[model samples]
Every structure is written in structure tokens, then in C-alpha cells.
Target chain A: MRSVVIAFIAGTLFGLGLTISRMIDPAKVLGFLDVAGEWDASLALVMVAALVVMSLAYRLAAGRSAPFFAEKFQVPTRRDITSRLVGGAALFGIGWGLVGLCPGPAISGLGLGLPQLAQFVLAMLAGMAIHRFWFLRKGSH
Target chain B: MHNFTPYSALIGGALIGLAAALMLLLSGRIAGVSGIVGSLLRPAWGDWGWRLAFVAGLVVAPLLVQWATDKPVSINIDSNLAVLVSAGLLVGFGTSLGSGCTSGHGVCGISRLSPRSILATVVFMAAGAATVYVMRHVVG
Candidate 1:
């Protein structure tokens, strides 16, 4: 129960961060990506600030044995690049470029209830389901 | 070169960092959205609370910000349904294949200096940049 509350608070903070950082705006994202043409460095600054905070947090957390709410850190063991990775990256790139919105911003953008974002989120979930059941299944067998 | 204070960006980044750290400290979780959502799909005992709360918080936080700041965002994606759907599927596929998303690997994992996450983040960012180039310049 407490963990859930904490998760909600954490998620809220994250979403708020995205909103305030102007990351939810596709134009800003595109501007940041337009390095050769215009070179909007706002997003870079955001990234740098994010990295600094994350570094400090990591430094503090590294000393701890266990998390406050959960049991252990849920890190993945697999490290090699596979077909799923290559294919997924292609898809993510296409989606992000077309819309200038990735999962984090897409999910956070839900607050605005735009139809396009809704479509993106739904399609994203459907894709996830299809990959988990169809593609991964075939690969494993 | 530009005179940008980065006040909002800094505060926001700090909040996110603090949240990620707190989640680790309290829940021992990595604050990965894909993992949290994936866990919800195949939920085990005592897993529902954090995932649900995390998702809920994501939904509500913006509303609070909008209310407070009066600077609600408006998104304009000029793509057809087919394009949007394909893109979503791709991200979904990518998240699963990579074992995490930007939040999981790019932000949190890289913070911990995990090698796998570093590779994954590089691939993800490169893929995104390449896609944007192809779509905007080449295809158009």
C-alpha cells in the first residue's frame, strides 16, 4: 500500500518534470533535434540537468543494500543485441520522428487528452502485446 | 550560447532524480515505466500497488501542474493513423526487445552506470535520430 502511494507520487513528480521541462511539446523536441539547422539547445540543457540529478541519486543509492519499499533492484540480465532489439529500435525511431513523442512524453501527454496521443498510446500498447505474444513466441521456439 | 536560466529544467530534473532515487530507496524498484506496465500485465502477489500508483501519479501530476502554472501543453502530431499505429507498435516492440524503455534504461539504468543500459540508450537515441532524419529529410 505504502509502496503504491510512493509510486504514484514518484510518477506524478516525473510527469510534472516532463511538463515543466517543455519536453511534452513536440516542437521543442524537434527544435532540440534540429542541431544542424537551428541547434535549439534547450533540450540538451534539460538532458544535462537530468543527468546531474540522476548521477547524484545513483551515488547515494549505491550505498544502500535494499530499497525502501521493494525487496531488490529489478535489473535485467540479458545484454546482447538481438533481432527484437534491432527491430524495436527501428520502430521506436520511426514513431518518435514522425510524432516527436516517445513513451515518456506520450504517457505524460495523456493529461491533455489529445486524440493523436490517445491513438499513439493505444497503438503502442497493442504493439507491445503483439510483440510479447507473437514475435517473442516465434523467436523462442 | 543562449541565455537560458534552465530554472524549470533544473527543478524538474531534480524532482525526477529525487523521485527515481526515492522509489529505489523505498521500493527497491528502478522506476522503469515499461517494467512497471509489463509487471501489471502479469501481476504477482504484492505487485499491484506500486504499478497502479505509479501509473496513476503519471496521469495526475500534469493536471496539478496545469492547474498551478496555467501553462497547459497542446500537442500537434501531423501524421496519419497508419503512421501513428506503426510507430506505437515499433516503440512497444523496441521496449520489449531492449528489456526496457528510456525511463528504465536511458535515465535510471544509465545513472547506475550499467553497461547494458548504456548500450541500449545509445542504440535507442541513435535510432530515434536516424528515423527523424530519414522521415524529415529523405522521405519528405
Candidate 2:
């Protein structure tokens, strides 16, 4: 119960951060990507600030043997750079460039009452479902 | 530089970090939005509640901000339905295959100094930049 509450609060904060930063705006994101033409590196500054704080926070979190409400910290252990990793990232990048709406901003935009964003999200859901179906059929993780 | 927002960007980023930190400290989670959504797509018995709550929180954020500041969050996107649909599909497929997105790989994974995350971020960022250049420059 408490875990759920905490998750909700965390999510709210994350969404708020994205909103206040104007990252939910595709034009802002596109500007950041426009390195050769009127580039805006402000978002990079955001990422840098986030990285610094998260690194410190991670150090503190690691010191604790267990979480406050959970028994263990769930961390990804895989370190290999598989083909899927690179290829999929490339695909994701293309998609991000095409629409300038990564998952975080897109999901955050759900309540923003935008028809274009709504269409993107619905298509995203469809893509997720299709990917899952294809993965199950292949059974080759 | 007209749209530059360094102060808000940094402050909002800090808050995001704080949120990620809070989630990790309190619940032992990475606050990976994509992973969270993926879990909800095929939910486990003990997992659905928190996952749903988190998504609900995400969905409610704009409303909260509007109520608090009396401002509508602006969203700029490609208006072409074909582009939007294709972009959404690719994002879904790619994030799933890569196993993370900006939140997971960009924030949490990179902060941990994981090699995979580093490479993935570099690849994606470069690819995104290249795609933008091609679309706006080479073809334009």
C-alpha cells in the first residue's frame, strides 16, 4: 500500500519536472537535436543536472541494505551491447527525431488534451502490443 | 537560443532526480517509466496496483499543473498522421528491444555508469541527431 503511494508520488514529480522543463514540447526537443542549425543545448544541461543528482542519490541508496518499503533494489545487471541494443536504439532515435516525443514526454502529454499527441500515444500502444505479440511468437529472447 | 530555458531545465531536472531518488529509497525501484508501463501491459498479481498508480499519476500531472498555475501545457508534434503513427510504432518497438528509454537508460542507467547504458545513449542520441539532420537539412 505504501509502496503504491510512493510510486504515485514519484511519478507525479517526474511528470511535473518534465512539464515545467518544457520537455513535453516537441519543438523544444527538436531544437535540442538541431545541433547544426540554431542548436539549443539547454536540455543537455538538464540531463547533466539530472545525472549529477542521480549519481549522488544512487550512492546513498546503495549504502542501504534494503529499501524502506521493499526487501531489495531491483537493478539491471546486463552489460552486453547486443545487436538488439544498438539496433533498437537507432530505431528509437529515428522515431524520437520524427516526432520529438520520447516515452516520458509522450506519456506525460496524455492529459494535455492534444489530438496529435493522443494519436501518437494510441499508435505507441498498438506498437507495444504488436511487439509483444511478435516476441512471444519468436520465443528467442 | 530564443527558447532556451536553462534555469527551469536544471531545476526541473533536479526535481526529477529527487523523484527518482525518492522512489529508489522508499520502494527499491528505478523509476523507469518504460519498464513500468511494460510491466503493466502484462501485469503480475502483486505489481498491478503500484504500476497503475504510477501511470495514473503521470496522466494526472497536466491537470494538476493546470489547476496549480492556470496554464495549459503546450505540446509540439509532427501533425502528419502517417509520421505520428510510424514514429509511435518505432518508439514502441525500439524501446522494448533496447530494454529502456530516456528515463531508464538516459537517467538511471547512465548515472550508474553502466557500459551498456553509455553505448546505448550515445547510439540513440547520435542516431536521433542524424535523423533530424537528414529530415531537415539533407532533404529539406
Candidate 3:
């Protein structure tokens, strides 16, 4: 119960942050990505500031054996720089550049009652399903 | 740039970071939206509850904010259906293949100094810039 409450509050904060930062606006995202055009360097600060805070959080977590409401801190342990990572990131970037939306922003955007965003979300789910069925099930990892 | 907003950007970013911080310190979970949602596809019986709750909060918060503030969440997306679909497909497929997305790898992973996350961030940022350049310059 505590874990669920914390997750919900964290998610709410995240959604609010995305909204206030205008990261949910696809046009703004594209502008940030469009380095050749009138480059909006605003979004870079989002990453920088997020990094700063998360870094501190990581430091705090390092001192503790477990989370307040959970058994252990679930962090990714993979260290290899694999082809799959690079390839998939590149493809994801292409998609991001194409639509100027990511999973977080895109999912949050659904609340605004945008038909186009709904279509994108549906297609995104389909794509995930496809990957799950084809790549994941086939032991592609 | 007319749309440049450093103050809001930083504040919003800090809030996002705080959110991640809460998740890590309280729930011992990474606040990576893509990873969270992806895992739901094959949820362990005991693990899906928080994920669903988190997603519900994410999807509902904006509505609550709009109601409270009378300021709807601002959003502008591509009008073309086909392009939107294609972009969505690529995003979903790629994020799955990569094992993370912006929040996962970009914010959480990079902050922890994960080599893979750093490399992934660089690759995706470069790819995004290059794609934008190509679409606006070469194609347009």
C-alpha cells in the first residue's frame, strides 16, 4: 500500500513536471531537436537539472541498504555497450525526431484528448506487442 | 528563441528528478516510463499493481491539474496519422529493444554514470539531431 502510494505520487509529480516544462508539446520537442533550425536549447536544461537531482538521489540511495518501502533498490546492472542498445536507441531517436514525443510525454499527452496522440499510442502498443512476439520470444537477446 | 523557457525547464526538470528520487528511495524502482509500461505486458502477479497505479497517476494528473488551474496541458502533435503511427511504432519497438527510454537511460541511467546509458543517450541524441536535420534540410 505504501509502495503503491509512493509510486502514484511520484508519477503524478512526473506528469506535472512534464506538463509544466512543456515537454509534452511535440512542437517544442522538435524545436529542441532541430539544431539546424532556430535551436531551442531549453530542453537541454531539463536533462541537466534532472541529472543533478537524480545524481544526488543515487548518492543517498548508496548509503542505504534498502528503500523505505521496498526490499532493495532495483537498478540496472548491465555494463556492456551492445549493438542492440545502439541500434534500438538510434531507431528510437528516429521516431522521436519524427514525432517529437517519447514514451513518457506521449503517454501523458493522452490526457489532453488529442486524436492524433491516441493513434500514436495505439500504434506504439502494437509495436511493443510485435517486438514482444517476434524478438523477445525468439531469444534474440 | 521565442519559446525558450529556462526557468520552467529547470523547475520542471527538478520536479521530474524528485519524482524519480521518491520512487528510488521509497519503492526501490526506477521511474522509467517505458520500462515500467513494457514490463506490464508480462507482469508478475504481485508486481503489476504499483505499475498500474503509477500509470494511472500519470494519466490522471494532467486532468486534475487542468481542473485545478484551468490551464490545460499544452500539446501539439503531428497532424498526419500515418506519420504519427510510424513514429509511435518506432518509439515502442526501439525503446523495447534498447531496454530503456529517455527517463530510464537519459535521466536515471546517466546520473548513475552507467556506460551503456551514456552511450545510448549519445547515440539517440545524435540520431535525433541528424534526423531532424535531414527532415528539415534534405527532405523539406
Q: What's the TM-score of each model vs. the native?
A: 0.89, 0.97, 0.97
Model 3 chain A — which ten-residue stretch has the worst lDDT?
A: A132-141
- Indicate the TM-score of model 1: 0.89
RMSD of 3: 1.2
Q: Report the Cα lDDT for residue B98, model 3.
A: 87
Candidate 2 runs further than 4 Å off: none
- TM-score of chain A for each candidate? 0.86, 0.96, 0.96
Error of 3 at A102 (Å): 0.3
Q: Which candidate number would show the highest DockQ if scored against the true structure?
A: 3
User: Going through the candidates in order, what is the number of backbone clashes in each?
Assistant: 5, 0, 0
Best by lDDT, which number? 3
lDDT of each: 0.72, 0.85, 0.88
What ordering of candidates by TM-score runs from best to worst?
3, 2, 1
Clashing pairs in 3: none
Models ranked on lDDT: 3, 2, 1
DockQ of each: 0.60, 0.80, 0.84
